[model samples]
Target: MSDAQTQKVLDHIDADFDNSLQRLFALLRIKSISADPAFAGDCKAAADHLAGDIASLGFDARVRPTAGHPAVVAKSNGKGNGGGARPHVLFYGHYDVQPVDPLNLWHRPPFEPVVTDHADGRKIIVARGAEDDKGQLMTFIEACRAWKSATGSLPLDITFLIEGEEEVGSKNFAPFLAANKDELKADYALVCDTGMWDPNTPAITTSLRGLVYDEVRIKAARRDLHSGLFGGAARNPIRVLTYILGGLFDENGHITIPGFYDGVKDLPPDILAQWKKLNLTPETFLKPVGLSIPAGEKGRLLIEQVSSRPTCSINGIVGGYTGEGSKTVIPAEASAKISFRLVEGQDPAKIRKAFRDYVTARIPGDCKVEFGDHSMAPAIALPWDMKALSAAKKALTEEWGREAVLFGSGGSIPVVADFKKTLGLESLLVGFGLDDDNIHSPNEKYDLKSFHKGIRSWARILAELAALPR
Candidate 1:
């Protein structure tokens, strides 16, 4: 296809932008919360809805069953394995969303998708899944729709692997991939579940932090005791737990876990220089959330502390509680949820063992500590010199009229590792989400400009990919 032909498809995307938004809104209305079992039927409904929607655009689509929630697989190939002449690309996204707890924080209903004005006057799409995998995924689908509508077919062989179990750690989706690896094979994968640098600046995630989640429980005395009778005489599990977990951090905000940073390394000097120029000050990042401190390692840039360094966090803790008033009792047990965000070269199993060792040594003779493993995965770093990366950078730069920033994301997408391990395929992560999108939080939104320009950006990228040498 010529450049002019791609331009025609871009023009179509611009002209039919409203219908594209309507399609996205339709998908967003489905309550596919995979974490909660009550929404199981809704998760299947979401898969069916997305399969039909993709089938409408001239692909063979199906809602395949998994051990848990269902997944949708759609393919657009003209014949004989998509003619075997053009490059094959697989696009991955998720239809499931985070559970909408604390619903009172939302300005409107979580499932009622609507375009509204931001406090600063920018138009935004407000809903639970907006700017997450749902809204970001549609950008690629809408681009494909434009290409098919304008010129009869996509520039390359396209396959879509949309799952309904991402937010729940994708425990079942990896097995689903193994069951269908032969069918999902492609030259490369495109993942649209990441974020841009800022609202105006586009970015492609080059590296991702790994994750190790643990649930620790400390048990002592075997029963609750009245504080009046057992005060300072009996063991308090909560105090012991808090004391140990609190010591996980020290005066300089460094994780006190031994050998936690053994494999972690600093970014190269060239990349460090580039990050310094970006200048992600606390005033711009932290101030929005009523904070003014970079709470990670001391003497590191805010960007490094967030995106490149290893750290640990206590996500939740619970021991004893009263319904409304005060309960003066010494609890027999206490537990806390801990997570470690690991950088490149760190080992998840090693980190998990180290954490357990650190906690076990501190347990008193009267107490026992039990751990429940939740998740563990190592980090991913894509080489910066891939030809597809160049194509995407050029295409994003053209759409945003500014250079696209390439940086490591502090978040983890474990499926990226699965894609590599299972299919032997590398993934290119691109999306238009912003830091303030509140994805997984209340009042989540997707900037209207991101939705519109994101479609156009993918349209150009598809053309560029098709033109690259195989």
Candidate 2:
């Protein structure tokens, strides 16, 4: 691709930005809340609307049915330069928004998107799905539209996969992917569901922590007992549960489970050096949360503690309680929900087994223990030297006039793992969201600049990817 052609696409994006915002507003107006059964029609409407919009760009777009809300699949004509294959990418996004609960808190209707001035003087587009995904996804679509209008063709083969069940756990989406794996094949996947380092800085999420959510129930007695009558003789399940949980971590904040770190590896020297320069301190990362200490494994960077290192957290615990400040009873059963944030090289199943074994070994002889599984997913880490990653990073850096930060996120996006496992494709995660976007909350907004510049960024990325050797 010629630089002149790329410049034309970027120029078109700048000129047509108003129309881009309008299109995003049209999408944001659809109350496609996947979690509520009452909004099922809205979800289908979103799918159909997106399919038609994408089809306007000459793609073979169609709304396909899933077990739940439908999915939009659109593919380019696949005519490569000189009849040779080019890099093909499957762009992924969601059309669903979280339920707008507590409607009284919103300044305007959650479905009514508008461009407004932020308190910080930045132009923001406020709506329920503004930043979470509607705005973010439209950035890529608008970029494609610009390229198509400017050059009459896309720079490479493309497939669009927009789903409507992300907010809900995507339970059926995975099966949809499995059933259509052949038709959805691509060289790589592009996901816009993440955030940048900061409003001024660009970022590519190179790693995502996996999850192991489990619940443990301990029962020491069949019936509740009075504290006064059995306080000394009865084996309290709550006491047993807390005692075992207390030993799972050491003073240094490292998990004490055996073989928990079997496959864990340290970051590369170059990446570590870059992270050191970023200088993520507790004051900047934790102070806002009313915390002042780095509470992960000792001797690790605060960034590493949250992103790269594996961790175990007790999400919730419930046990015997006194009601009305009068009744004191040792409940027959006590339960706790625990979760583990895993990193690359750590297996979720093994971690889950190790944790269960650790708790089982420490249980009192008379107490009975039962474990319930909630969710488990392995961690994902992209190769540091991936060519597409380098290309996209260069494009973002140019767009933002600052070096893009390749960072690891502490949370998980299961679809990225599914792309690798099911389609044999790695994902390149890039987005223009800020830390305070208030996604999944009231009054969610997307920066107007992020919307416009994000289109320009993707246009440049497409050009850079096309220039690579086929």
TM-score of each: 0.90, 0.98
Identify the runs in model 2 with alpha carbons over 4 angstroms from their true place: 78-84
Worst 10 residues of 2 by lDDT: 77-86
Per residue, candidate 1 scores C-alpha lDDT tens digits across 254-274 of 999899989787888988898
The models' CA-based lDDT, in order, is 0.91, 0.92
Candidate 1 regions with alpha-carbon error over 4 angstroms: 31-42, 78-85, 98-112, 224-235, 320-331, 441-443
Relative to the true structure, candidate 1 reaches a TM of 0.90
Q: What TM-score does structure 2 among the candidates reach?
A: 0.98
- Candidate 2, residues 1-470: lDDT per residue as tens digits? 89899999999998898999999999999999999999999999999999999999999898999999999999886331123478788899999999998899999999999999999899999999999899999999999999999999999888999999999988988899999998888778999999889889999999999999999999988899999999999999989999999998999998999999999999999999999999899999999999998888899999999889999999999987745666788889999999999999999999999999999889877799999979988899999999999999999999999999999999999999998889888999999999999998999999999999999999999998887775
Worst 10 residues of 1 by lDDT: 77-86
